[model samples]
Target: MPSVDPAASSMYTNQAYNTTRTTDATSMDKNGFLRMLTAQMSNQDPTSGQDPNQYFQTISMMTEVEQMTNVATSQTAQLSRQKDTNAQAMLGHQVSYITQDPTTGASSTATGTVASVQFDDTKGPSLTMADGKTLVDPDSVTSIQ
Candidate 1:
């Protein structure tokens, strides 16, 4: 009896099984796919050759995956821009945010007019008040008025 490679066998099981978790554009490039194709070709048996249709199917699946990734990235960027625009519109308007003063360390009310809104890469949004104090979370506001 001849031994079989489990990885090679799994490749033919389902198209979904081959999908890799590549969220970024760089990770889903042509070179990465070429490497995968090469690996599949190398592992295939010489006597029982892989079907040419399977090769084409794999390429089609990869193209679909890349398209889906691009769509998701575009949607995310649009959502971010919308959020920033909404935040900017809130400027000069009173907005409530749940906040605990760093100095006081007490649950007290701090209400001020909105001076400006700032968005950070990791921190999301920060609302700067007329009193020169910056509030990080929007939920920290007790009252908008």
Candidate 2:
């Protein structure tokens, strides 16, 4: 009977499976997860194969996360659209809102008619008064007439 050494086996002498870190440590995207799964599959031991059920479960989880992320994004976009619509509807109406002095750093309340609405991605909706000098934040509005 001939003895076969495990260390000299051809199955264990392949290259190491190294997956590069493309994303931050806290979170991994779907593409990163797929790349990692591929690497793992390619390097797994042949004799004792990985469970098919485990692979299916991991894929399912990834799919669920992707769907949830899409849903959240859609909800955010819908909310933004609704806000824009609401801000536009305030046109030709008088609104009372808090105002602050830039130099004196003093806060006061002011009333103005909504002349126009500006949609800013970073600032959201800003209402330009009839005077066109004052810019009012939609959130700062206290009363509408």
Candidate 3:
């Protein structure tokens, strides 16, 4: 059996194995935590086992990550509401947008007064034209008169 250096073993870090970095490098999500934990378990020195303190710290960190994700999700929902409110204020104001035909995949410009705004978590904010039937994306608006 090969001998292991105790100090080197204790000093092992996730950085050594994490060869790639993504746009969200500043964050360690739940999945990231799990991957790191799995790696640690797989690579640990079998004779010494894991430090109990480190295990507890990992659990604490996971809780912190869960809280952070909740807060971020809440903030996003709040911002979406704000955007919907702003879109609602545009009701009765003239707006123009590009329309696409589902069958032909052709685009055309249409102009009408904003009649209503719909807030959807999946679709964000959408506008209903004064025509009472035409639906448009706020982002599709080319001009506001």
Candidate 4:
């Protein structure tokens, strides 16, 4: 067998075996974490096994994180539905809101009857006045009659 240089072998090992950097700068997401964990488990010395308790702890933490994420997503959807209901209830009701002139940059208070409500993913709930000209956000309404 030919003699191998230790420095070249070490460099080759680093180049071949090291984990790649993730796209995120601040933190590793779930997929990255799992890949890293799998690599560590696979490469650890078989003579002295890694602690089983550490794996259990990691699994328990991942479960808790996933559960919390699900709960938050559910709550957000619930809140959005509630807002839609509230906006719908305001239909045919007179509302007062502030408006600004496009030409002169002046603020004025205007009253209008809510003819329809629209839900936008980007802009949230908006009310269409009876006139069909003005669009008002439910949050912008100062008074509802």
User: Sort by TM-score, best first: what order?
Assistant: 2, 4, 1, 3
- Residue-level lDDT tens digits of model 4 in 55-89: 99998998898889668767766776677778889
Models, CA RMSD each = 16.7, 20.2, 18.3, 18.5
Off by over 4 Å in 2: 1-26
Better of 2 and 4 by lDDT: 2
Candidate 3 runs further than 4 Å off = 1-52, 120-122
TM-score quality measure for candidate 1 = 0.61
Model 3 over residues 4-68: C-alpha lDDT tens digits?
98644433122213336465658776788789889989999999978899899979978887898
Query: Model 2 over residues 1-145: C-alpha lDDT tens digits?
Result: 7998743442211111224435568887888889999999999999998899998999999999999977876777677767777888899999999989999999999999999888654456789999989889888999999
- lDDT order, best first, reads 2, 4, 3, 1
- Cα lDDT of model 1 by residue, 1-145, tens digit: 8889854442212212235544675455766788988998999889998888988998898889889977877776676666666666667877766666679877665566788776665445567887776664554655565
Cα-based TM-score, every candidate: 0.61, 0.78, 0.57, 0.74
Total backbone clashes of model 3?
0
lDDT measured at residue 123 in model 4 versus the true structure, 0 to 100: 58
Alpha carbon lDDT at 53, candidate 3: 95
How much is the lDDT of residue 42 in candidate 4? 90
Ten-residue stretch with the least lDDT total in model 2: 10-19
Best by lDDT: 2
